[model samples]
Target: MDEDTPRLLADTNPLPETIDARLAQQLTFLIEIDRLKTVLRQSPLAAADRRENDAEHSWHLGLMVAILAEYADENVDIGHTIELVLIHDLVEIYAGDTPLYDAGKGLDQREREAAAAGTLFGLLPADQAARFRALWDEFEARQTPEARFAKAVDRLQPLLLNWMARGGTWRTPGVTADDIRARKAVIGDASAALWAAGQELIDEGERRGWSRPGSASIT
Candidate 1:
């Protein structure tokens, strides 16, 4: 290791010399994730004036999986689903948060996130790096039931926040309810019940002028 490595470790939390390579790698990965706390998201907190961060969003998704698993359309492995949720946004630490309505940013999101995933997940040991990357890939593919439900929860989260905040993101110029519905209709794929609830919020948002009108459908 470089001379700077030891000082870097000491500057943060110092670990015992007995720590193995795997443990050191794991710890490094954990420390690296602290940067996620600084990455801001578009969804604003209902009670706070500032926007939420990537780490907060991931934690909220994990909690949402725990509390709302029963609402999933198919029976899902809660732990796996939670893992997917927690791992999904780690890429944002490097790639930055991409707003749903920003078509320009959305265009290169997949490429940007893929590169970020490699950089972030590579901090772990080989086995763990593969495992975490697999989880991230599964969440991105949205093929498995756990991944689908995790994605549904992911999409539902900001919708709930926007509704609770009374047009949080919807209030943005040119961001209409129809545009949101068109984008968010995927929520129904994993949980019809949750989508039903989300649908109500979107409709009410439009009626209340929380979001402007557009041409589209939800589910």
Candidate 2:
């Protein structure tokens, strides 16, 4: 099923005690995550009227894992990397989407998202919640190869979208090449080839006068 589609809730019809507990909890968690589709991101959809949502972003990142896994500096478990990207943005449902260039907007981002992760993942069964939360934390820590690759793709996706839209988000008044580089440093750390690809896009944006040099923050 598409990750964004809402599943039938177990509570919609009263369940007998015989219903499997794990299955019921999993279904509930799935239904809740469907809210991710409503959490619109700052990045606009390419050639579309609307913005991309957390669910679509996660799905795209999952596809990137399959397509770009070869570029990772160290061998990574594709399945684990997919899992990490799939849930990385679930917290955005509660914390809300923070634009890549809007550094001042999410001043308490870590604390807010950490609490959001706890609540969202906690909806799953005990073991599954713990495991999924661990994956989210791993992605945040960026220590393991899987986490690093996942983060690289996470950064790469927005850059691709902005380039496609001819500087969609990058056109924000104060956004600059330096802001892109600062936010996208992880791409180089995990995959030099992918980083080069991203830089090529940025260079083209600059050449076309779609992106300009400026500081993201004045203070």
Candidate 3:
């Protein structure tokens, strides 16, 4: 073994055997998640000058959940919903951000993200890792009310940002309004009010000529 390797391991020290390892595990996981700050997404910030990273995306989703929970079609546990949003993209810290418009790569993407989830969440103790993994899975599955709402906001955030930026990513060739609408359809199922807000943004984008006239029909 390298001389510094043992020293680095010693610094971690695994806490004390008698100490509750939960705190240490949780802290380790928290520190690992900070890597997300460096994982940039394809979507640009509202300013449209630069892209937003996964950490900012998760933070925005958390705030959206707080502000929009009341509009969910079904009652949701707000805390659980927040947890779902915050950790949903932690896998991206390893898998990297796949653009929403990317097609023909879903299977590979899922496999990559699953492996990422395993390694990243494994930083926590077994029990906490399982819980975190389950939350991420639930967000992907979108079966629970909380998960559905979280997914809706996840889709909504970028759409809103794109709208505010006058077609941040939408302006890119091959990104159609229909593509956006189809991707955002879940928001309609989750919250009519939020869906209405999203549609209004889309309409404004159309009116301002931010989106190509025929782009909506491309898909």
Candidate number with greatest lDDT: 1
Please, what is the whole-model Cα lDDT of each candidate in the order they appear? Answer: 0.87, 0.85, 0.82
Per-residue lDDT tens digits for candidate 1, residues 1-219, read: 223222233337666778897888788788878888998999999779989999899999999999999999899999999999999898887788999888778889999899888877887889999999999999999999999999999999999899889999887777778889888888998999999999999999889989988864322
lDDT of 3 by residue, 1-219 (tens): 223211223245455667567777676667667778999988879765898999999999999999989999999999999999999898887788888777755548989888888887887889888999999999999999999999999999999888778788877777777777777888987899999999888877977888766535432
TM-score of predicted structure 3: 0.86
> TM-score per candidate, in order?
0.91, 0.90, 0.86
Rank order (by TM-score, best first): 1, 2, 3
Task: Please write out the lDDT profile of model 2 over residues 1-219, one tens digit for every residue.
Answer: 234423435457655777698887887778777788999998878768778989999999999999999999999999999999998999887778887777687688899788888877887889999999999999999999999999999999989889888888878888787777777777998999999999999878988888877654522
Error of 2 at 24 (Å): 1.5
List candidate 1 stretches off by more than 4 Å: 1-18, 216-219
Q: After superposition, how far is residue 120 of candidate 2 from its true place, in Å?
A: 1.0
Q: What is residue 132's positional error in candidate 2, in angstroms?
A: 0.6
